[model samples]
Target: MAAFLGMRGTGDWTDSDMRPKNWRQGVLWQYPNGDAPLTAMLSMMSEKKVDDAQYYWWTQGIPAQGGTVATLNDTTALADDFTTGAVAGQTIYAKVALAVAKHFRPGHQAMLRDASDYGVDTRGLVTAVVHNGASSYVAVKLIEDENTGTGTNLTDCDNILVTGSMNAEGAAMPSAIAYD
Candidate 1:
């Protein structure tokens, strides 16, 4: 038998101290926290190579507010929409990260949407995460095609990104889950 120590910052995978002796030695997966606004926020910085809000649009995260737990440790159903408060007219969805305990079904497409329920044009990859203080599972809608292209639908998403760390930090893992 082998020992697999679980740590944080494995880059969307279970942090394990031991190496995988075989194909299934350890379980590593991506956990969603929320649709991070970093992309949109950075786009505003004139110093950086930024793009339009549409390129940073992502529909995958919990609402910044109003996440109440009905029971102790019960899986909470959560959702979030973009706002102009922080990033001008552009808005980004919040979501939790995927986890090792679960596997994101491959080849899934999420229809991206906005507050108006209209499909908008976007570019680049969306970084999702698991929000703070939640169970392993999150709400996700699988996509039939990966052809998100330059303008994927916002209404649909594969998974709602949630907080990454299992700890109380409630943010992405500061360091690699398991560094060499």
Candidate 2:
């Protein structure tokens, strides 16, 4: 009774083998092509690194232009804010607005915005199938406590769906993603 094998190939959770070979968008989470049930996109459960984008900035991911949301992250965004580009580091699909799905318990620290998967954003640990481009989309490595000394600051048109940080196997599973 323990042989699920879902993502089809399991290679980076499928979806055409994940991606990120040369696209730009540091954070991403799309899962839902077939079965669904994989959540989590950034680490969280007790480490308390829950940040939100309300006043921080950085952007640049224009292969076809679908990675907008820039104010300073770098790449000079402003083409009506990208819409769906492709290669520079791979993986860029934004449009979020979440408010549920919380089971964090691996490292404690989660978030999602403008990562419109529809289901209200943020599911469980979508597991990590990722990377970034030369600071890919300009620095997006905020781990914890920033500006207010507690962690979380991704302001300026929030955009998330980066499900890439899952390794749960002992209790708290439902992944993560709990915003409001």
Candidate 3:
């Protein structure tokens, strides 16, 4: 079997939807040889990017695989990768805090932006989010050159509560709301 990556959510354990309490202790990946393999996970602990212990494990112990296995948990990085056109299999897991919806504007062509940096912008085929007055919604879209001009507006939900790692198919962004 191929080596599969293991992930354990490290969030508020007291919360009703909290995941595992320990992310690394029980987190593991089965390898051909029982030899313990290094692991890495990423998240935005605060305003800054947060990478799990695996980052140090790989950087210091084993070399990272060639693929861009990005844990999209970082909002800023997610936008950046998507803007540059994320690879077909580039892994990304993130937490979205707003309404996750799909958008398809016939004549309106927009691109994903780096919302993490607050002001930095990105240009991609998909529109990550659509700003509305004082609120924002996670506006995701599929803009594959091969799938364009299909004339179908693809949207799913109006919002998403705290959830686990999200795998972006086309262009998706994690929306944030201020609690002032």
Candidate 4:
């Protein structure tokens, strides 16, 4: 399993701006209290790069605030069409409704799961969107973290949720926020 890399510290518990002096790339700094969930406000900052380019971050929680964009087609065979019978490092082409094709764009983070059981789920980064008149697909490169099932089980991926996105390096900030 992959580990979350960062510093764990103790403080006065009142400083809202508390953070580690050294911030490593790909490390999500989470401060947890003994036997309880985080009770303090959390803030994060990225160190300035040598080139000074700017990057933006956005996040959406589960039971997505927006309406459903699409769901994995029930008829497709998961092993042959979606994943390589494993959870991570495979590029899965998830079939979705053509009507919602416009919402699955590259660079988006997609979270998929069975509606009845949330534990059977996976999250991946959208690498491509193929739109056909009758059928459409979202090609997602699976992120190696936080997957719960084999990911090849068709019944385990009945819902699709786009949680977040990351633009290309040096890309300008988006002018607006749109949710589907």
Best by TM-score: 4
Q: Estimate the Cα RMSD of every predicted model relative to the unseen true structure.
A: 21.8, 21.9, 18.7, 12.1
CA lDDT of each prediction against the hidden true structure: 0.29, 0.30, 0.29, 0.54
Per-prediction TM-score: 0.20, 0.18, 0.18, 0.48
Task: Report the Cα lDDT for residue 136, model 3.
Answer: 30
What ranking of all candidate models by lDDT puts the best one first?
A: 4, 2, 1, 3
Model 1: lDDT of residue 172: 47
Total backbone collisions, model 3? 5
Evaluate residue 119 in candidate 2 and report its C-alpha lDDT on the 0 to 100 scale: 27
Candidate 4 local Cα displacement, residue 27, angstroms: 33
Instruction: Give the lowest summed-lDDT range of ten residues in model 2.
Output: 95-104
State the lDDT of candidate 2 residue by residue for 50-110, as single tens digits: 3753433355442321234332222223123433211233222222211211222233323
56 Cα displacement, candidate 4 (Å): 31
Candidate 1 ranges with C-alpha deviation above 4 Å: 1-91, 97-131, 135-152, 160-174
Candidate 2 Cα errors over 4 Å, as ranges: 1-143, 147-153, 175-180
